[model samples]
Every structure is written in C-alpha cells, then in structure tokens.
Target chain A: MKKLYTLIKNDLKLIVRDKTLLSFLLLPPVLIIAFKFLTPILVETAPILEEYRVIIGMFASIQTAIMFGFVTSFLILDEKDENVMNVIRILPISGFYFILYRLLFATVFSSIAAYAMITLSDIAHPGNLEAILLAILYGMTAPTISLAISTYAKNKVEGMAYFKGIDLLLMLPIASFFVGSSLSMVFSILPTYWVFHFYETSYNDAPAFEFFAVGFCFFGILISLLLFQFRKRVFGR
Target chain B: MIHTKDLYFKYPGAAQNTVNGISFDVGAGEIFGLLGPSGSGKSTTQKVLFKLLSGYQGSAQIKGKEITDWGKELYSQIGVGFELPNHYLKLTALENLAFFQSFYDEGLDPMELLKMVGLEKDADKKVGEFSKGMKMRLNFVRSFAHNPEILFLDEPTSGLDPSNSRILKDIILDLKNQGKTILITTHHMEDAEELCDQVAFLSEGEIKKLDSPENLKLEYGKRTLEVRTYGSNEPVIFDLDQLKDDKSFLELVQSGEIKTIHSKEANLNDIFIATTAKK
Candidate 1:
C-alpha cells in the first residue's frame, strides 16, 4: 500500500510538471462547460439535432474518456523516453504491478470524468443504473489507449501519430448508430462498438444484457492482448 | 557472498555465448573488478548475477542461496548502479531518492545520500538541469541508498572530474570498511588498481588472467632495474636477480651517487593490454 501510494504520488508530480499533461487536468471541466452551453444552441439551430442529442451526449462522454486515456498514455511515453522503467525493473515492485496501478488510476479518473460529462449534459438523460454501466464501460477505454500506445510507439512523437490513428478507430462505433442492427454487427470486432451498442440498446428499451456481456468480453480480450504485447515490447519479457 | 562456477550465457538467437566458461568468487567485504574493453561480457556477467538475464547453464549463488531460487527479495539485498544515469529527470533529486526509497522497507535518508554525493545543495533542483558529472555522482550513491549487503557498480566513476572521482572512491572504501561486497566493471585501469582487491582481465567473453594487482605486476613485469647517477647523463641497467653480486651497482648506491633507482614493474594498463591482446 505504501509503495502504491508513493508510485501514484510520483506520477502526480510528473503530471503536474509536464505542460502537455497539465492541460489534460483542465480538459474535463473545459469540455463539460462547452457541451453544457453548446447542446441547446445546436438543438435550437437545426431542430434535427434534437433527435441526436443522446448520441451527442454519448460522444461527449466518450471523448472525455479518450482524452483521459491520452493523458495516461503520454505519461507512460514520458517514462519510456527517460528509461525510468529500466530503473523500476530492478526494484522490489514488478513492472507489471506498476503498470496495473497506472491503469487503475486512469480508469477511476476516466470513469468519474465520463459520469460527470453524461449527467451534466441534459442530452443523454440516462437512468441511474444505465449511467453507472456506461461510465464503467467508458472507464475501460483509458487502459486500452495506454496499452496500445505503449505497445506500438517508441516515443512521444510516434505515440502522437499512433494515437491519431487509434482515435479514428474509436469513432468507428458511431457509424453503427446510422446503420441497421445486422449491418452494425460488422463493427462488432472493435471494442468501442460494443460500448456504444450497450448504450443504444438501453436507450431504445431493447435487451441490453447481451451487449454488455459481449462488450466486456471484447474489452477483456483486447486489453489482455494489448497487455501481452506491451509487456513483450516495452520490458523485453 | 557471491559465487559462480563455469557460468556461460548465450543470448537467444545469438551464435555464441557472451559469457563463456568463467568462474569467480567475491567474498564479503571484498572488491572484485571485471576489467575489459567493449563487448567483453562485463555487463552481461553482471546481468546474469543480478538475475536480470536467465537461462544460464551453471551454478550461481548469492549470499549462500542459488540465484534462481531467490525472488524479488534479492533486490533488497543487492543494489545496481547502471553505466548510464537513469533518473526521473523532471523530479527533484530529493523526490527521486524518496520515490525509489519507497520500494524498500528501509533505506538511508535521502538528504544524507544527496550530501554524500555532493548534491545536497541541489536536492530541490530538477535532475534534468544537472551536469553529467553531478548526475553520475548521484547515480553512484543511489546504488547503496537502500544500504544493501552487496553493490554492483558499472563504470561508477565514468564522466567525473578527478576531485569528484576521489570523493566517490573514498565513499566506496568507506562502504568496504562497513563490510559490503562490491563488484565493479570498468575499463579504467586506475580504478581497478586503486579499488579492486582482485581483478579479472576479461576479453572476448573469457577470463584471460585473474590475480591481485601486485602479483600481476610481479608476474608480467621486467626483471631488471635502472640506475642514474648525478654527473652521468646515461643510466645503467642491471639484472634485478644479480644486483647484489654486482659491485659497480652497489658501489654507486653506497657512494650515494645514485640520482634515481627505478624498478621496471608493469602497471595495470600494460598488463591489461598484454593479457587481453589476441594470442
């Protein structure tokens, strides 16, 4: 417990010192404020946007989660750039445990940020239970981004390029809402599609449990695979 | 406290072993040096001993237990100072020490460690702003901040000025007096001569020669002496074995006319070159 506290505290200091990461601390409140004011204006302007307010709300929350994921991934890239992991490998704490702790920290932060974005936006008007489930699913996005960046990118320059590509993939789930259910299944291979499917089914009063189960399984498998690649490439395990 | 027998290590997919059939023991309170040029397996041997690299086909023990049998607890008893200084560059020196200190149950005070390395005044300053020598000094002391029983230092004095190097060497001697075994890998012959109780001249992943500094000099040095008397521009050379039977040599010494008398003993640089040179 003491070791974990120390590690987290050290990470916090690094975050505060980094200008790029410091901006992420304000990202949630800034985006939330922007969404709060802009949603009603968009509805007033198009009136067709009224039908897509829930999707807009969902986009806002997922975007917040993705941004938090970027924060954590950049933190990891900073450590890799400085070769801090090599020093940590010799310590009593295992490198896997340290990474687990970072993911957990990011998950909690992203979950809370997503929940705040969802509840404050007035567009996604979800029930308490649905909101909790969506928040949990959104939280998983943080670690997925962290693992993907660590596995594929060697430094921050490459991380930025890889992250832009990943951002395009994360948005693929939005295409499912426009297409039919049978056609939407084509996007099921992506983990984010299932997350959006769970939200869509619950909002439409359809069976949501299967989507939740499939979403979690995909999240589990993708996270596991990414973790494996991350361990092998980053630590040479 | 450390022992290895016929240790051999070959990297995965490599053609040959990097550490090949080498054996040595480092007792408690002793300093052992693995001296070699690049690619001589000095770092590889240290990695195998520290459990960083596995799949060795020989017996290796640390503190009387097989290295493979030990867990992460082994790290608490053994500290490693890498050849490159690895620190959280954005964090202050004090914070860096405190963060690493949290990994162990007990560690020396961060302030004291910084003071020992002459970085106390810069404790609050970020490491990224430090000079290479300052970072190297900090890297040297960080190895034993946990007060480990054994220390592995690679190029500990590399990149330091003479004054700083002397300070680090003095601290190492102090640690030795406190009964901690130290293993150092360096290319600097002066470091090997001044710090090591025993040194192994490693070349191409093999131990070519191993002995004390004095003994190596005796075994490989010239068996003669040179004498220069005042008023004579030319020096005279005599066989060291027959110096006592040479009247002229004795007469110059007895008459107090000898300006300088020097024995031709090999230094570690000459010995290192001679031993590691391809036969």
Candidate 2:
C-alpha cells in the first residue's frame, strides 16, 4: 500500500511538472465546463441533445478516459526514454507493481472525471448511483484500452500516433447508439463498446446486462494485456 | 563480492556476443576499474555484473552466488550510479532521494546523503534546473542512499571539472575507508590509475591486460634514463643497458650539469596505448 502510494505520488508529481501532460489532464474539465454551457445552447436548437443529454455528459467523462490513457502510456514511455525505469526496476519492490499503480491512477482519475462531469453537466441526477457507477466504468476502460495500445508503442511520438489512431475506437460504441442494435455486435467486439452500451441502456429496460457488460469490458481489456505480457517480452526485457 | 568466469553475452538476434569469454573479480573494499573504448564491452560487462543484461553464458557471482540468482535483495547490497545521471526532472533533489529511499527499508537518510554530496542547499530545487555538474554530483551520492556494501559506478566522474572530480574521488575513497567495494568502468585511463586498486584493459570483448596501475607501468615501461645539460635545450636519452659504464652520462651527472635526470617509465596512457594498441 505504501509503495503504491509512493508510486502514485511520484506519477502525479511528474504529471504536474510536465506542461504537455498537465494540459492533457486539464483539458477534460475545461471542455466539460465549456460544453456544460454550450451544450445548453446547442440543446435548444438540436432536438437530438435534448433526448441524449446523458450521452452528452458521457462524452465529457469519456474524454478523460482518452486523456488519461494517453497520460498513462506516455508516462511509462517517458520513464523508459529517460532510462529512469532501469533505476526503478532495481528498487526493492517488484517493478510490475508500478504498472498496477499506473492502472490504478488511470481508473481512479477517470472515475473522478466521470462523477465530476455527471454533476457539472447537469444531464442526470448526480445522486443516481447506478448512473454514476456506469459513468465511472465507461471512463475507466477507455484508458485501459489506450494503455494497452501504448504498451506496443515503441516510443512517445509513436504512442501519440497510436493514441490518435485508436481514438476512433472510443466513439464506435457511441456511434452504435444511433445506428440501432444491428451494429451493436460489431462495436461490442471492442472493449469500449460495453462501456458505451452501458450508458445507452442505463435509462431504459434491462440495466443488468449493460452493467455486466461494462464489468466484462474492464476485465477483458486487463486480461488481454496480461496475455500480451505473457506472450511477449515487454517493458524492456 | 563480484566474480566472473568466462562470461559471455549476446544481444537478441545479434551476430556475436558483446562481452565474450571474459572474466575478472572485484574483492570487498577494493576499487576495480573496467577500462575500454566504446563497443569494447566494458558497458556490457558492467551490465552483466549488475544483472541488467541476462541470458549470458558462463558465470557472474555477487556475494558467492550467481548474479542472476540475486534479485531485489541483490540491489539492496549493490548500489549503482549511472554515467548519464537520470532522475525525475520534476522532483526536487530531496524529493527524488526521499522517493528512492522509500524503496529501501534499511539504513538511509536522504538529507544526510544529499549533504554529503553538497546538494543539501539545492534540495528544494527541481533537478531540471540543476547544472550538469550538479546533476552528476547528485547522482554520485544517490548510490550511497541505499547503504550498499558494493557499488557499481559506471563512469563515476564522466563530465565533471577537475575540482568536482577530485571531490567525488575523495568521497569514493571515504567510502572505501568505510569498507565499501566499488567497481568503476571508465575510458579515462587516468581515472583507473588514480582510483582502481586493479585495472583491466578490455578490447574487442576480451581482456587485453589486467594488473595494478603500478605493475602495468613497470611491465610495459621503457628501461631508459634521460638528462639535460645546461648547453643543450633537449635531453639526451640513454638506454639503461650499461648505465655504470656510460662515460658521457656519468660525466654529465657527476659534473652537476644535468638539468634533470629521471627514469623514463610509462604513464597509464602510454601503457594503455602499448597494451590496447591504440584501438
């Protein structure tokens, strides 16, 4: 627990010091604020946002998952680039524990953003436990997928390209919302599809499947990353 | 506490081993230098000993066991101060040390270590703001934070001014006096001379020569004497083949006209060239 705290603290310190990363982290909240007001104006004319206000809030929350994922991957990559990981690997604790802490940072921060967006966007009841919990799950897994993609990124610039290229995958689950249930299976192949599906199905009938789907997506992304590490040497083995 | 026998390491998919069939030992409380130019496997050997590179043939032992056998516990006993001085650029010097200190449960006081390296004043300053020399000094004492019995210092004094180098050397000697074993790998032969109790000259992944600096000088040194007279601007060299019967040499010395007279022996650079053949 102490080691995890120290690692998380260290990561936070690094993120705060890095201007590029700080901006990425701050972007979600700023956009949520901008969208909070602009969204009201847009809903007046656009009939779609009035019915899909929860999705609009989900958009703000989900952007955090994307940003945090980029932050997590590049943070790990930066450690390698600076060769500090070599110093870190020799620490008394297992180096793999640091990866856990990074993932912890990802999920925790994304959850906070989800809750924060839900409250600020005023699209739903902030006290809605199931809705906020679903928001958190959706927020958490997007970065988890991004984190997995970053593991394959050879360097920072490549990590950025990977982040941008895979950014489209996050919208797939949301896009499936308008296209009807026929496209749901295709999007469900992506881990993020479960997250978007949970939000889409949360207000209507059959909330239990959507809830299980989100959990499955979160664990699925993790299990696949575990398999990746097992099959190939990574983190500079 | 370090011993290697027939050590060999080849990177993945490489044609040949970077460190091939080499061996050496560094005893407790001794400074052993691994000397070589780039691509000669000095770094590779250090990496193998430090367990940074594995999958090598032969043996490297730390504290009576194979290097690979020792894990995180091995790190506790063996400290490393790298050449380039990597640190969290955002963290203050104190924060960085304290952060690393959290990784070790044993004896450590980050402030004292910082003060020992004259970095206590800049303890609050971010490492990114530090000069290169300050960074190097901070890195040198970082090894001390873990209270390791053996230290693996890769080019300990790589990019420091003479004064800072002397300061660092003095601190290393202090550690030696306190019974810490240190292994230093450097291309600076003079560093090997001044610091190492024994030095190994490596070339093309093989040990070309291994001896104390003094012994190497004696073995490869020129067996000659030179003297300068008041009239001559240049010294006259004479072989020590029959020094007693050399009439002119004796006359110049006896007449007290010899401006300087000393045996011509090898400095470390001279011996380095003689052994490594200017590779």
- Most accurate candidate by lDDT: 1
Interface RMSD of each: 1.0, 1.3
Off by over 4 Å in 2: A26-38, A54-58, A115-133, A142-161, A178-189, A207-223, A226-234, B277-279
Pull out the clashing pairs in model 2.
none
**Clash number by candidate, in order:** 0, 0
lDDT by residue (tens digit), candidate 2, B249-278: 888777988777888878788876766765
Q: Chain A structural similarity (TM-score) per candidate?
A: 0.95, 0.84
Q: Compared with the true structure, what per-residue lDDT tens digits does model 1 show for residues A1-237?
A: 777778778888988998888897779889988999999998999999988877887789888888778888988787788777777888987878988888988888898988888887777756678778888888899999989997788899999998888888987888988999799888888888878877877877777878778878888888899999988788777
Model 2, A1-237: lDDT tens digits are 788788878888899989988998888788768877888788888877688876676566677557777788778888766667778777777777776667666777777777777676666433476656666675566446545665677788887777777777666677777776676577776666666556656655444565555566565667566536622545446
Worst 10 residues of 2 chain A by lDDT: A227-236
- Among the numbered candidates, top TM-score falls to 1
Candidate 1, residue A200: lDDT: 72
Off by over 4 Å in 1: A179-183, B227-236, B251-260
